[model samples]
Target: MSSTLAEQRAEWRERIAGIGDTLRAESETNEDLRQLSPATEAALRSVNAFNLCSPEELGGVNAHPRLQTQVIADITSHDSSAGWCALIGAHESAWLASRLPDSSVERIFAHSDERWPVTCGSIAPEGEAEQVEGGWMVTGRWGWASGIHHSDFILSMSRITGQEPEPGKPPPLLCAAAPKADVVVEDTWHTLGMRGTGSTHYRYENVFVPDEMCLAGFERPPLRGGGWLARPTVTFLTAAGYGFPLGVAKRAVEEITRQATEHTRTGQRASISEQQHFQGDLGRCVALVEAMEGYGHHLFEELLAAPINSLEDAVRMDDRARAALRWAHQTAEDVVRTAHEHAGGPAVYSDNVLARLLRDIQTVSQHVIQTQSAYIRRGQHQLGIPVRPGL
Candidate 1:
C-alpha cells in the first residue's frame, strides 16, 4: 500500500476504535428503538463514517476497497447494527454521488458543512417506473431500506415500464433518487438481528423523479471518483458485505474468550477456559475469523488490482469476490454459533454480547447475496456447466 493510503487506513481505524465504547454502550438501546441511538449516530458522524466511500471532491475519504472493508470490520466489531448501517449508508451515498447528474450531486452535497448526506435504498428492481415527459413516475414499496430513518435521500431500483430487452438481454432498469421527504417509511423492520439498522420497508407512490436524479442502469461507470469507483459495484459491495459477519464473529470470539476466564459450566469444577473442549472450540473460532479476514482482504486486493476490460472480466471478479464472501459468511456463522454454544446459559441472555452476536450473524446470513446459489454457481463454473450471467 502507498504511504498515504496506509496512513489513511490507520486514521480511520483509530477513529472507529475511538467510538467503540459509545457503540457498545448504546447497542441495547439501539436495539430497543430499532435504530442507532442518537449518541451512536453522532459518534459515527463525527468521524465521517457514512462518507468513507464517497468521492474525495465531495468531502469524503474515497477509501480503497480494502481500507473500506477494514473500516466496516472495525466498526462492526463494536456493534453489528452500527457496522451494517455504516456499510449500507456509505455505499448507497457513494453510489448516488458517483452516478447522479452533476446538478443532483451538487444539491445533495450542498449542506456538507452542517452534515454530510447519508443515503438508504433498495437495489432490487421491485418497483415500476412509467416513462413521462421529463422523468419517470415511480411507485413501489421497497423492503430492507436500511438507514432510511436517518437518510437524506431515498433510492429505488425500478423497471422501465415500456422498455423490453432484446433476446438474451436483461430488462432495462432505472435507479431513482428522491429526497427522503418524498417517500413514506413503513414501520416494518422488526427482526431477529441488526434491528438497529432500521431496515424497514419504504413506499414511493407516484413519486416523480426528475431526469437529473436518476440513472439509466445500475452498472454504469462512475462519473466521478477514482478507479475504485469504476470497478463493478457488486464486487466492492461484496467486499464490504463480509465486514459485518467477520466483525461479529471476531466479537463473538472476544466475548467468549473473556467469559471463559470467569465462566464455569454448571456441573464442572474448572472454569470454561480450563476445559479442553472449550479451549479447542475457542481456538478454532479464532482461527476461522483470522483466516476469513486474510482471505477476504487478499481476494479483494487481487480483484481490485486486476483490470476489468470487459463484462466478462467484471463478472469474473464479482463471482470470485462473492464466493469468498459466502464462505466468510458461513464461516462467521459457524464461529458465532460455536462461541454461543460453548458460552452456555449466560450466552442466552439478552444482555450477553454473545446473544446479540449470534442473532446478528444469523440475520446477516439470510441476506440474498449469501445464499447457497453462489456456491452452486461456482460449482457449475468449475464443472464446465453453463452458469447464469451476472451475480
Candidate 2:
C-alpha cells in the first residue's frame, strides 16, 4: 500500500533523526572550517527534509507553524545547524507561493528541475527594480541568501519606485523571482554558527522579471498565477519566519534535560539529575518551553482567524505575533544558557553538542525581531502609546 502523507512525514522524521548523529559530528567540523560539508547537504536532500513547509497539494507536508516548529525542534535536539538549514530552506518556496498568483502554482510545482526551496532576503533596499513594459528590470546584490547553493530558484528582494507608505499603509515588500541562470552565488557565508547552511551572497545584474513572475500586493488577480497568496503577505510569512528560533530553542531545552539525566561530575557518583539544584534548573527550562509553546499557539490561532487583506483587523494580531516571537526567543536564550551551565566545563568543548547548540541558539536570539527594540515597539503599540519612528 502507498504511504499516506502523515506516514511519509513520520518516515522522513525518523530519517532526519538517524542522521542527527552524523550531522552533529559534521557540524563540529564545519564550525572549524566555517563551511558545511557536501556530505551533510546530500544527507538533507536524500530524506526530503526540506519539504516540510511546502503546501499539501504540492507534495509537501504543509504543516502549520506550530507543528513545523515542533518538527524542527526534534531535528535540532541532536544537531541544531542541520535543523536550522533544513527548516529555513523548506519554507522558502512555501512563503513565495503564498504571495504569487493563483494560476502560477501548478507551473512552479510542475517544473521538475525546481528542487529545494528559494531562500532570499535583503530588506536594506539595496536592490533596484526599474519599471518596464511588461515587467521590471531588477539589478543589485542581495546579502545572506540562504539555501541557494542547492536551490532551483532565487526570490530576490528589491526596492521599486513607490509613494512613501502612510499610516496604516501596508506597502509591498518587493520580491522578484529568478532562475539560477539569472543569479550568481558569491560563496560568502562566514559566520559563528549555521556556517554549513551555505547562506551565500547573490548578485543579480539586469534580470528581467516578467509581469507574471513579479509579486506585489497591489497586483491583485495575479497574472494567471496560483498559490497560497490569494490574500495578504505580511500577516502570513512574517508569522512563519518566527518559527525557526522556536525549533532551535525547543532542541536546546531537550538536550539540556537529557544531559542532566546521563552525565555526572568528576567528584560526584550520581548524575546531575540527582542534584536538587539541577532539578530546579531543568524544571524551569521545561516551564519556559511550555510558556513559549503556549504563546506561539495563541498567536497562530489568532493569525488563522484573521481575514485576508484586513490590515486594520490584523494590526493587533500582528503585534501579538511579534510579541510571541520576542517571548519565544527570550525563553530560548534562557533555557539554552541554563542547559549550557548544567553541562559544566564540557559545554565549552568543541566536540560537544552543547557547545554548538549554545552557538546556534545565540545566533538566532540575536535576530532583530527578538531584540529589545522590536519588543518595546510591539508593547507600546499594544498599549496604545505613541511609538517613535525608526523602531
Candidate 3:
C-alpha cells in the first residue's frame, strides 16, 4: 500500500508538472480577479489530487504524512493556490476519517469517485445548538473555510443541544457533519495571494444534525476497556494541517534555485549559481529544508505508527508535532526569503516565477499555524510558565 501510494503521488506529480503552466496562468488571473478559475478546479478534480490524505480504510489510499507534504511542495512549486487548495481538500478526508460513520465515509467516496471533490470545514467552537427529538439543531458562522466553493459537504462546529455554559464560558465545539444544503457559502476570500483557495465564510441556520452525524472532541463515549485509536479528532486535524504550506515552502526553495542559476546579478555576467556567495546562500537554504524535512518526517512517522493513544500521550506528541511545525515554518520562511533575496530584482518582477512563489509563500506563511507568536505561547505553556497574550 505504501509503495502504491508513493507511485500514485508520483503520477500526480507528473500530472501537476504537465499542467502546472496552465494552472499557473489560470491561477495568476484568478489572483487578479480574487477568485478561482474553472480550469484550475477541473484539473484538480480530474486528478483526484484532493484524496491524497484519505485513510486507506475509506476506499482511498492513505499516503504517509511526510510523503503527502512532499507532494504538496512539488505542486506548490508549480502553483501555490492550487497546492494550497489541493492539500486543504485532501486533508478534509483525514479529519473525517476519525469521526464519520462508515456509511457517510462511503458516501464521500461515492461522490469523490464521481469527481466532485469537497474541502473546507468548521471545527472551531462558534455556533449555537439546541436539543431536538432525534438530534440537535445547530446554527453558526464559520470563517476561513477554504475550498468551500467546490465542497459537496460542509462540516460545521456547533454547541450540543441543551448544553449549559458557565457565566463566562462559551459552548464547546461539536463536529456537525452535514451536506452543503445546510449552510450557505460566502465568496469572501479576497486576499493578497492564493486567491484560488476560495477560502470563504459559511453560515448555518437551524441545521438538524443526527447523533451519528455529530462528532466532538471533548465529548465521546469511552471504550469499555481501552483503545488508543479512539482518541480525539482535534489531534489528527492539527497534525495534518501543517503539510500543505510546508510543501509550498519546499517548492519555493526549488524554484528559487532554478531561477537563481539562470539569471545573472546586476554586477555580474555569470549566473548566481556560479558565484561563491550565491552558492553559500543556496546551500544554507538547502540545509534548512533538509533539516526541517527530516524533523517533520521523524515526528510524523511516530504519530502514524501510534496514531492517537491517550489524551496525555496525544498531548505529548502534540508538543513534538508543534515543534516540528515551528521548525518547518521557520525554515521554510528563511528559505523563501533567501530565495527571493538571492534571485535579485528581475526575479521580483510580476512575470517571474520567483515573484509568484514569493507571494504564495508569504501568503500561506502568515497563517496561524505558522505564526511565531503561537509557537512561543505553546512553548511557554509547556514550560509551566504563564503564556503571554499574542506572544
Candidate 4:
C-alpha cells in the first residue's frame, strides 16, 4: 500500500542520478549566474532534496545519514555547483530543523510537498536587538549568509544590548527569524567557487521579530523536534560541512579516470590509463578518498552514539567529529590535487571537470569547520595546552 523507506530512498537516489545529467549541462551557467537557475532550483525542490533530515512530522523524509551523505556526494560527481547547492540546502534544512522552535518548525513545514519557508542562519550574533514591547528591533549586516537568495525566511543572530541575564554570562544572544522582505541582500558572493550558492550579505534595519520567532540562546533545550535530531549541533554540522569536500575529491578522481581512459600525452604511445604513473596516482587518490570518507563516517557513527547531555560529553563529541573532518578535509585536498596533477594540462581549462573540482574542493576546504587550523586546536587540547574557549 505504501512505499517502504528503502524504496523511497531508492527512488530519491534515482532522481538524483537523473538530475546529474542536467546539472552537468548547466554547471557553467550556474557558475556564471552566481546562483542556481530558477529551473534548477525547481528541479531540486521536486525531489525534496533540501530537507533530507527534516522531522517526518514536518513533512520531510527524515533520510538516514548514510543515504543523505551518499546522495549529496553522488550529485557532486556530475556537477560541483549543483552538488554544492544540494549539500548546502539540505545541510541548512537539517541544521535549522534541529535548532528552530516548534512553532517555527510547524510553519516551515505547513506545506508537505513544497520546498518553501526554509531559513538560513549565521554563526555569531551579527544584529543588535533593541528591546521592544512584543520582541526586539534588530539591525545589522550579516555577511556570507548562504541560502539567502533561495530562502523565504532568514534568521539572524543578535545580541540583546540591555540584558544582563546571568552573572558570568555576557548579554544574551537571540536567534530570531524574519521575513525575506526585511532583508536588503547585498551582492557579495562573487567567488572562485560555490558561486551558485548565492551566499550574499543581507542587511536588517530594525527588523522586528516576535518573541515566538526568537530562540533563546542559552536557556533553550532543543525546543523543537527532538527524536530525529538526537545528535548535537557538532555531530550534524561537522559531518554535513565535510560532505562537499568528500564529493569534490570523489568527482576529481572520477574525472581523472575518465580522462586517463580517453586521452594520452602528445608523445605518449598509450592512453593515460595505460601508463604506470597514472595508474599509481589514480589508485593512490582513490584509496585516499576512500580512507578519509570511511574513517569520517565511522567517527560520525561514534559521534551519534556519544552522549551529549553534559558539557564534557559535548566537548568530546565535537572533538571527535572535528578531528575526523579535519583529516578528511586535508586528505581531500591532497587527493584532488593529485588527480589534477595527473590530469596535467587539460585540467587548466574552464570547461574541464577537473578544473571545476579543483576550484570547488579548495573553496569548501577553506570552511572554518574543515580548515587545517582545527588540527592546531585539536593538538593543543591533546597536549595539555590551554586552547581558546569553544575549541
Candidate 5:
C-alpha cells in the first residue's frame, strides 16, 4: 500500500476509535428516535466515515475496500446503526461518483465544502422513469432507503417506460439521482432493529432527473477511480457488507464477557464467567467471530490478487465474494445468538446491550445479499448446474 493510503487508514482508525464512547452513549437515543442522534451523525461526519468508498479527487477518502470494511466494523462495534448508515452512505457516495456523469458528480461533490455529501438510495427498480424533453420523470416509492434521512442526494432505480428488452434479457433500468428536497421520505422505518439506519420508504413523484444525473445500469465501468473500483459491483461491495454483522457480533461477545465477570444468574453460586458451560459457549462464539474476520480478510486479499480480465473471471469473483458474505452473515448471526442466550435473563430487556446486538444482527442477516439462495447458487455453480444470472 502507498504511504499516503496507509496514513489515511491510520488516521481513520484513530478517528473512529476516538468516537467509540460517543457512539455507545448515543445508542439508546438513536434507537428511540429511529435515526442517528445529531451527535453521532456529527461524530461520523467529522471522521469522514461516509466518504470512505468515494473517489479521492472528489474530496473523499476513497480508502481501500478492506480498510473501508474495517472502518465500518470498528464503528459498528460501538453502534450497529451507525455502522450500517456509514456503510450505506459510503457505498452510495462511491456509486454516484463513479457511475454518474461528470456534471452530476461535480454538482453533488463540488459544493460540499463543510462535509462531503452523503448519498443513499434503493437499487431495486421499484420506480418508473419516462423519458422527457430534457430528462426522465420519475414516480414511485422505494423501500429500504437506508440512511435516507440525512442524504443530500437520493438515487432510485427505475424502469424506463415503454422500453422492453430482447429475449433472455432483463428490462432496461435507469438510476436517477434527485436532490433530497425533491424526494419524500416516508416514516416507515420502524422495525425490529437497525432503526437508527432510518431505512424508511422514499418516493419521487414525477421528479425531474436530468439526463446527466442518471446512469443506464449498475454494470457500467466506473467513470473515475483506480483499478479497485473496476471490479463487478457485487465484488466491490462484498467487503463492506461484512462489517455490520462482524461488528455487532464482536460487540455481543464483548458484552457477554463483561457480563460474565460481574453478574451471576439467580440460584447460581458462581459468577457466569466461572461456569464451564458459559465458558465453552463464549469460547466458541469468540472463535466463530474470529474465524469470520480472518476469512473475510483472506477473501479480500485473494480478490485483490485475482485478475478479472473477462466476464467469466468477474462472475467467478462475484460468486466467491458473495458466498463468503453469506457464510459470514450466518456465522455472525450464530455468534450473536450464542452470546445473547448465554447472557441469560438480563439479555431479554430492551436496554441490555446484548439484546440490541441480537436484534441488529438478526436484521442484518435478513438483507437480500445475505440470504440462503446465495449459498444454493454458489453450490449450483460448483456442480455445473445452470444457475440464473444475478442470483
Candidate 6:
C-alpha cells in the first residue's frame, strides 16, 4: 500500500508540474476575480489535482502527511491563492478521515469521483445543534469556509443538543458533516491576500445530521479507516495547516531570487545580487526557510512515530505538533518578510508576484492555528497546565 501510495504521489507531482505550466499567466486574474477562473479550474479538475490527502476507500491517492504537505507547497509556489484552498481542503480530508462512518463514506463516494472527492471544513466550532431522533438538527453561521466553491460536502463544529455549558464554560462539541447542497455560502473572503481562495461565510439551519456524520471522539469505536486516519485528527490538521505558510514563504524566496540580479538602487550600478549585504540576507533567508521545512518534517515524523494509549499522550503529541507548526509559521513569516524587503519596490506592486506572496504569507500568519497564541498554549502545555480548546 505504501508503494502504491508513493507511485501515485509521484504521478500527482508530475501533474502539478503540468498544471503549474499555466498558473503563472492566470494567477493574477484568478486572484482578482476572487475565485478560480473557469479555465484554470477546469484544467486542474481534469488531472485530479484537488484530491490531496483523500482516503483510499474514497478513491483517494493516499498521499501521506509529508507528501500532502509537499503537494500544497508545490502548488503554492505557482499560485498562493490556489495553494491556500488546497491546503484547507487537503487538511479537511485528513480531519474527516476515520471520523465518518462507512455509511457516510459510502454516501460521499456514491456521488464523488477522482475528479472531485472531498469537502471543505471550517476550523472553528461556531455553530449550534439541537437533539433530535437518532441525530441532531444543526444550525449555525461559520466563517473561513475555504474551498467551499469546489467541495461537495462541508464539515462544521457545533454544540450538541441540550449540552450548552454555563458562561465561561465549555459546551459539548461535535464535528459534523453535511452535503454542500444543504449549506448556504456567502461571499465574505475579501482580504489583503489569497483573494482567490473564496474562504467565505456560510450558514446551515435546521439541517438534520445523523450521528454517523458526527465525529464524537478520536475513533471511539475506531472507524475502520487505517494509517493516518487512525491517528489524531486535530494534531494532523495543525501539522498540515503549516503547509500554506511554508508554500507562500518558499514562493517569495523564489521570486526574489529570480529578480535579484535585476533589482538595483536608484543611483547604483550594481544589482541587488552584486551587493554583499543583500547576498548575505538572501542566503540566510533561504537557509531559514529550508531549515523550517526540515524541522517541521522531523517533528511530524516523530509525531507519527509516537504511540497514543491515553488522552494525556494524545495531548502531549498534539502540543508537540502544534509547537512544531508554530516554528514553521513564525519562521515562514520572517523568511517572506525578508524576501519582500530584499525585492524592494517591485515587491509592493499590487500586480507583482512578490506583492501577492507577501499578502498570502501575512494572511496565513493570522490564522487561528498559526497565531502567536499557539506559543502561549504550548508554554502552558509544557508546564502541565490546561490550555484552551482546540489544542
lDDT of each: 0.85, 0.65, 0.66, 0.71, 0.85, 0.73
Better of 1 and 6 by lDDT: 1
Residue-level lDDT of model 4, residues 210-305, one tens digit each, is 777776443344545443255656556665556666788888887888888887778888988998987988888889888867876676666656
Q: What overall lDDT, based on C-alpha atoms, would model 3 receive against the true structure?
A: 0.66
> CA lDDT of 311 in candidate 6?
72
Summed backbone clashes in each candidate are 0, 10, 1, 0, 0, 0
TM-score of each: 0.96, 0.80, 0.82, 0.91, 0.96, 0.90
Those runs of model 1 whose alpha carbons end farther than 4 Å from true positions after fitting are 1-3
Q: Candidate 3 on 211-318: residue-level lDDT in tens? A: 767653534532111222233333344444565556666776777777777788888989888988888888887777777667666766667677545555555555
lDDT per residue as tens, model 5, 282-381: 8899898888888887788789778878777777788878888888878888988888877889989999988988888888888888788778878888
Best by lDDT: 1
Worst 10 residues of 3 by lDDT: 222-231
lDDT of 6 by residue, 165-202 (tens): 78995766878888898999987878988788788899
What is the descending lDDT order?
A: 1, 5, 6, 4, 3, 2
TM-score of 6: 0.90
Give the TM-score (vs. native) of candidate 2.
0.80
Which regions of candidate 2 fall more than 4 Å away from where they truly are? 1-25, 29-39, 46-48, 101-107, 112-117, 161-173, 218-235, 238-243, 261-271, 307-309, 386-391
* Shift of residue 387 alpha carbon in model 1, Å: 3.0
Tens-digit lDDT string for candidate 2 (183-269): 877868877766656666788899898877765543343332233223233334444455566666677777777787778988888
Error of 6 at 229 (Å): 2.5
